[model samples]
Target: MVMLFESSTIKNITIKNRVMMAPMCMFSVEKEDGIVTPFHLTHYESRALGQVGLIMVEATSVTADGRISPLDLGIWSDEQIEGLHTLTSRIHAHGSTAAIQLGHAGRKAKTNQPAYAPSAVAFSEDEAIPTEMNEEKVTETIDAFKAAALRAKESGFDIIEIHGAHGYLINQFLSPLANTRTDRYGGTREGRYQFLRETITAIQSVFEGPLFVRISAEEYHKDGNTMDDFIYFAKEMKKQGVDLIDVSTGGLVQAPIDVFPGYQVPHAETIKKAAQIKTSAVGLITSGRQAEEILKNQRADFICVGRALLNDPYWPKRAAEELGYVIEAPKPYARGWA
Candidate 1:
């Protein structure tokens, strides 16, 4: 059995249990874009009460231009900060550590305004081509990440996760296939990583919470992004003070994935062993016994749960019960746990 009581830590934040909530997009918020809608509070509070060790809020755009979808939550302005405070406080009240994934969609952005990337590439599925960014726009994006990190800190989250994986902006930069720029942000491997490196560095200037970057360890396309890329990216991030990597894969271009139980655990294992950084494993991890084995074998430091929990909100508590570990339920639900 995975030791249910085993605590997990990343930099300055400690989680009371091994299970973490993988960020799932709600895209449910008030029309103001930055403000929290009622749906977000209840959706997250239930997970908090369910006793997950840490809860990562869905990715919030670093700026309006960065939004993955128009309906996504954000903290680009002061107005967005207050509602997030309520979110953090509620998560804390349930004894769960709160985390948020800050992101920019890059060419993937589908908001009403024009989308942008290193080149004017359109996703195969989309009709509109993304506007390739100019030098000034790139610089401004970096600043936006920095300012967003500062605002997230002000919102009282215990940890900060950069959205580097799943074919987002940073992932675009990481892949040789998508980025063919001739500027400082392109060409060689070091050049490809320049955008992500700069983004993390700029965010570091304003925030010091546990820094976690979500990464797609493998790109499904063998030549597109190499495991060698992951090795290099992981080491560089650690050197730049990245505390943990939330390891997941295959969001490049929305293609179908061939997956099995714990298919992505190898990515976590590879990074933990090679880069010497803490890592969290996601993708089809559903049960306590499976999760425990991964931790015991040193495959992953933390277990990130997604869809399974959506199926059963008390998945953690039930897993503990099944594994012969005693865990307390919230008072309102204590009798059932007992």
Candidate 2:
């Protein structure tokens, strides 16, 4: 049997397959109000119809000013719940589990509003210097994440992933390269981890469903968090009741990286073994056989396809054919698919 096509359970949810459509931001919001648009509905539902097991929505901001871009989706307000509910319902109708990634851009935010970060640092020379988050700001942001998780539950999502990767607010806090402070929120590795630790604790208070945290295991710099640091973080997450770690690398700061088809798989494997937790391998994993090899060898529990799925909404069907395992298609495409 092809392991990629096999079912797996997380919490009380049974995902039909190991193939998950990795959350890639569309930045397609018609208005700056951060509401879901028709394009989003069509974009995500296509993958669901194509037999992908999990369709993770893009990075959704928890606050208006926390957005990476004005066009990013928002769960900061109750009004946005209706549109997201419709989206989750559409995905479910086609037998796909829906997940949303909650994120805050921090210093990387490009909006007109001033960005906020753990330290008053600029992402680059060209980027604006962000305001250092004070005690009140930190508490407010943590509360924002907790509130967003509740909103996700109200929207009918099956899972929630905290976007702690890609050099965002959480990453800034977790990485010593970006965070430099003497307070409890920075300095040592444990101090740097305090923000994410609190954020996870906050989200868990309200969200009981399967929770996942995506992290950049390798920061690609000498001073960045090492593999040992990542393993410690993963173990801590497991103790905190996180169900999975979606392992990806880089994006903490500007640094050269070697890119390859399965470059990020090794990190996932290391984290899984070191932490004794489930992990999803992402980054350029483009074929069924490759993904199957990883799963068969127990390198990673799930495969997250990003650009490959964007290139072809029916990438899973093509993968099934490559592995000589047929997956049932949506009824409308039955004639062509068969």
Candidate 3:
């Protein structure tokens, strides 16, 4: 039997299989207003129809200033609710659970507006230096996350993922390289992770479903956070009601990383074992056999397929065929599977 085709439960939600469409930013909002367009509907629905177990929407900003790009989607205002609701409805129609990744770009936001971070640091020398976050700003961001979670719940999403990776705002705070704050929100591990811990708590207040946190497990620099740091971070996340850790490495700062197939699998394995929490492994996981091997060896629970799905919307369907698991195709496309 193919374990990759097996159903897995995260909290109260049961996904149809272990194949997940990893969240990839689609900078196609058209007007830079952060509203969902027809492009988003077609893009995401195709993956659900492809038989992906979980379809995680890309990083959506909680506030206008938090957007990674002006064209990125937003869950900030009430106006975005209807379109998001329609999106979830369509994904659910195809038998795949829909999820959204809520995030803030902070110092990395590629907008004309001023950015905010744990300290006044620039992602690079050429980028704008971000303003250090004050207590009021921290509270506002937390409230924004809370409000976004509520909006996600209203939009009928089955899960909510906190984007704490890829050198974004949350990652910026957790990283000592980016965050040089002298307040309670910086310095020690507990201090560095305070923002994420509180954000999770705030999200739980409004959304009571499967919650996943994506983290950059390795910063790549010798002085940057290592696997041991992530293990401890994952443990703190578990304590705050996080159900899964979406493991990816690098992007905390620019450094050379040895990239190869399944390079991030060991990081996921270490966090899973040390933190005793479920993890989703991502990073160059392009084939079904590779995904199956990861599960077979108990490295991770979910295989997050990113660029592979973008290259082939029916990648999951192909994976099912390769694994010899008869996954149900959409009624109109059923004959193709036959």
Candidate 4:
């Protein structure tokens, strides 16, 4: 079997293929209530029907003020569970495992409410200077993640991925460039990792299913996290029993980055080897052959397709064609797919 189409297991969940639909925020939530709308249902279900093995729902905020935008999906309230449950049910019905990305946008939040972060810094001049979180707020935010994980379990998600990358709440605490606190939560590298470590521990307390953490392995700034820093973080995650590391780069106070196909694969490979952990490679990986090469070489265990899937919900079928691999289609599309 082609490595890309090969089945893999994490915890007790088996994914039919290595293709994971990366979480991309729809910014389509109506009424500003943070609930999943019909648009989300159709949007995600179409990818499931297209035979993607793991459908990772977008960066859903754990609190109302933590949203990247007012329209982002949320898991902060129990009332939002029903819509997410329906979404997961639909994805599972189409033979795909459903996962949700639990996140808080931190200083990147674009809502009217004041944003919170590890320090009172602005992501950019265009963005507002966020409030520096105190010990009370820190504990509260960690509890929010734990609460969100419970909601994820209730929502019928098979996997829960903490959104620790992309200069968001967790990333702010992880990146020295973003986190400049003198308290226990900042200062040294170990201190910087404290927030994520606690967050992971908190979620694990309530969540026993497969847990994944996405990280920006390569922050473009000179003073940002080095590969060594990333490797240390990965090792800590491995010790914590994190099932996978979805590796992506940049987005922490972005500097100039040279974009290329599979540019980020090496980081994933390095982390997988150094940390002795499974990882998912993402970023500009737009073709089946490219994905196959990554898996065949054991660079990463899974491939996360983002914008490409947006362009084609049937991206897996297109990939199968490119790889000359005959992937089984949904019954109704069998004739056309064949």
> Which 10-residue window in model 2 sums to the lowest lDDT?
120-129
When summed lDDT is taken over every stretch of 10 residues in candidate 4, the lowest stretch is: 248-257
Poorest stretch of ten by lDDT in candidate 3: 220-229
Candidate 1 segments exceeding 4 Å error: none
Segments in model 3 whose C-alpha atoms lie over 4 Å from true places: none
lDDT of 2 at 150: 98
If both were scored by TM-score, which would come out higher, candidate 2 or candidate 3? 2
Which residue pairs show backbone clashes in model 2? none
Residues 1-338, model 3: lDDT tens digits? 89899999878999999988999999999888889999999999999988888999999999999999999999999999999999999999989999999999988888768899999988887787889999999999999999999999999999999999999999998989998888889999879999998999999999999999999998878777767778889999988889999999888777788889999999898899899999999989988899999999999999999999999999987887778778777899978778
lDDT of 2 by residue, 39-144 (tens): 9999998899989999999999999999999999999999999999999999999999999999999999878898999999888887888999998999999999
Q: Please report, in order, the local distance difference test score of every candidate based on alpha carbons.
A: 0.87, 0.95, 0.92, 0.95
Backbone clashes in candidate 2 total: 0
lDDT of 1 by residue, 1-338 (tens): 34655887666788999889999888776584757888889888888899998999998998898788888998899889999999999999999999999988888887888888877766665457788888898899889989989989999998999998888788888888678888999888899889989999998998988899999988877677788878898999999999899999987665778899999999899989999988999989998888888888989889999999889877897788777888888998888778
TM-score for each prediction? 0.96, 0.99, 0.98, 0.99
